[model samples]
Target: MSTAGIGLGLTGFGVFFSFLGIILFFDKGLLAIGNILFISGVIMTIGIKSSLQFFMKPSNFKGTISFGIGFFFVIIGWPVIGMAAEAYGSLILFSGFWPTLSVFVQKTPVIGWVFQQPFIRSFLGYRGKRAPV
Candidate 1:
């Protein structure tokens, strides 16, 4: 399999483990593992150079710093706070991709139906805007 495919699997697992850790009363070990896997997966998927460039961009500084801080907090056993920080950082860092994600979700068979609902669409502020790739 290709590196990107492997990376995607790892990323999926990382997200799963992270959520599982949260569900299991904020387990520190699980969160740490999840964080490590997630970062490595991203690097592998995008390549080191692109990953560095993406993270080091001036516009992404705040998100990068926040994410770094969150990772540090997780390492120090502050799982709850670390997760909270990471969530905020993720939102900021990935805001640009939200439109693309929305489009994808809307195109899916099952999820699309739910996403098309008036209440859900309004809540998510999804006005069917197509993002430029």
Candidate 2:
């Protein structure tokens, strides 16, 4: 699939899990499942970024390891740490100003780059032989 396709899929997963989590709040077991799925979504995006980074720069061990650690943390923390982390982030942007700014920034190309900086241009290995640099 194309990069945009992968990114959009990840985004959909994140949204689905988050919404499910909200809907399941009243039911303890379902809530836990939703939380786990949410964590999985986060891990999925991190893995995609890491893979892309690997393709871009084979020697970028730091970036690879960073994503690996994030993946591990999200997996290990699912239903607890993951849920709390999401909650914290949501709370942080709960303000009217922050959400508005976030939307505005996302709409601006430069600002969007700022948000995607960590993963932007990171490579997903090409299907065939590597091209000459």
Per-residue lDDT over 1-133 for candidate 1, one digit per residue giving the tens place of the 0 to 100 score: 9999988888888998898999999999999889888988898898999999999999888999999999899899999899999998898898989978877887899988887787777778745543233
Per-residue lDDT for 86 in model 1? 92
lDDT of 2: 0.48
Candidate 2 local lDDT, 1-116, one digit each (tens): 75455655665665575567556553334444444554455446557566455334645444444434433444554444545554554443233245455446546777666543
Model 1 clash pairs? Answer: none
Native-to-model Cα distance after best TM-score fit, residue 1 in candidate 1, in Å: 0.7
| Model 1 misplaced stretches (Cα beyond 4 Å) | 127-133
> Residue 44 lDDT in model 2?
62
> Cα lDDT for residue 38, model 2?
44
Model 1 poorest ten-residue lDDT run: 124-133
